[model samples]
Target: MKIWVLRHGQAAAQAATDAERPLTAAGQQEVRLMASLLQGQPLDAILASPYLRAQQTAALVCTELGYERGVATAPWLTPDDDPCEVLRYLAERQERNLLLVSHQPLVSQLLSMLCEGHRGAHVPMPTAALACVDTDFVAAGLGSLVLHRTPADLSA
Candidate 1:
């Protein structure tokens, strides 16, 4: 299975609530750039946090992919949710490719947990960054990090 973890674009600092935060103008543009990197791929499903920023990010990617089904919102993808449940969920899914749009700390923790067997590797995830993993399945320390790209990296 190939899993892609994408951090939501940079959001406005002020919002009614953290979950309600929307992406800033720069954030929207950066996400579009990142989306371009995955265009033309047969990506199967997109699972994202219910937060507005993440929802917006997923929408942009889906647009770029020409996907019309809308994104599946998963509670486990929330900023503070545990990664184990998500790993279990992915292991049970039949799709070969999955994209997860989420927030920090959880996103950063997921990167280390997926790449390293443990959560020690501090993978720096700037907003709109993406990391691709090649794994037989989703589990603690069971996947291999194949790619990590930021919008600037793609632009340059």
Candidate 2:
């Protein structure tokens, strides 16, 4: 299975609540570029953190890929959630392709956990950055990174 994890675009920090935070104009453009880069991929499922930023970013990708607007909100992708559970869940699903839109630290942590079985071993995931991991079900240390991209890289 191949899993694509995308960090949410830049969002304002001073929002009344984290859930209410929205993406900035540049963030929107970043999403567009990221979406364009992923337009040709055949994503079997779309998952996202329930936060506004992640939801917004997922929406852009879905729009570009002609997927439905709704995304499955996985609590494990949330900022405060543990990534190992999510990894285990995905590993068991055996889906061919899955897209997950989430926040930093968590995205990076998840990648590290899958590839290295440890957290904080990889660089932090920047806004709108993506990491593609390929692995087999019920296997540990089987993940290999296929791609790691940022919005800026896509724009360039």
Candidate 3:
């Protein structure tokens, strides 16, 4: 299985609520640039957090990649959600390639947990950052981190 995790782009500092917070103009551009990296990849599914910023990011990715299936809003992709639950959810899915658009701590924790046995590694996922992991099955430490890129890397 191949899993691609993307942290939503930079958002405005304030909003009525965290979930309602939309991406800034720069955030939209960052997400578009990051999405271009996946242009030729075959993504079976695109899952994203319900947060406004994540949703916007996913949309940008869909546009960039020309992914017509659209994004599925997932509650488990929230910043504070447990990585274990995400693993279980991935285990249940049958997609060979999956893209996950989510927030900070969840993206970092999920990537670290996937690459490290017990979430020991500190995987820093800045806004618009992306990471790819490959594994025969979804589980802690069983996966290998094949790629990690941030917007800075893409823009450069």
Candidate 4:
């Protein structure tokens, strides 16, 4: 299985609620750029944090790729949520390729957990960044980093 993890795009700083925070104009454009980069891939599924920012980013990517949104909301992808459960869930999924759109610390933590098998080691996943991992879904913690890209890299 191949998993693509993406951090949510930049969002407004002061929103009425954290869950209500939406992406900025620049963030939307950055997401478009990221979507374009992923256009030709055969993504089997998209799992996202329930936060508005992450949901919007996933929606944009699905629209650009012409794939009906097969998005699943996982609480583990939410900010500060435990990522081990998310990893476990992904390991059981039947999809060969999955995309996950989420927030900072959680996204960062999840990548580190997937790559290193533990957390606390920082893997900075900047806004609109993506990390691709190839692994055997049946065997947990067996994966290799295939690619990592940030919006700036895409722009360049």
Q: In terms of lDDT, which candidate is strongest?
A: 3
Candidates in order, TM-scores: namely 0.96, 0.92, 0.98, 0.93
Which residues of candidate 1, in runs, are more than 4 Å off? none
Provide the clashing-pair count of each candidate structure. 1, 0, 0, 0
TM-score of predicted model 1?
0.96
Minimum summed lDDT over a 10-residue window in model 2 is located at 133-142
Q: Please tell me which model should have the higher TM-score, number 1 or number 2.
A: 1
Whole-model Cα lDDT of every candidate shown, in order:
0.89, 0.81, 0.92, 0.83
Residue 111 deviation, candidate 1, in Å?
1.6
- C-alpha lDDT of residue 130 in model 1: 94
Per-residue lDDT tens digits of candidate 3, residues 73-142? Answer: 9999999999989999999999999999999788888988888876657888999999999999998889
**lDDT score of residue 33 within candidate 4:** 83
Stretches of candidate 3 off by over 4 Å are: none
- The candidate with the higher lDDT, 2 or 4, is 4
| lDDT tens digits by residue: candidate 2, 37-105 | 677787888999889889899888888778974688877788867777776778667569899998877
**Model 4, TM vs. native:** 0.93
Q: Is candidate 1 or candidate 4 better by lDDT?
A: 1
How well does candidate 1 score on lDDT at residue 134?
Answer: 87
Ranking by lDDT: 3, 1, 4, 2
The alpha-carbon lDDT assigned to residue 141 of candidate 2 equals: 62
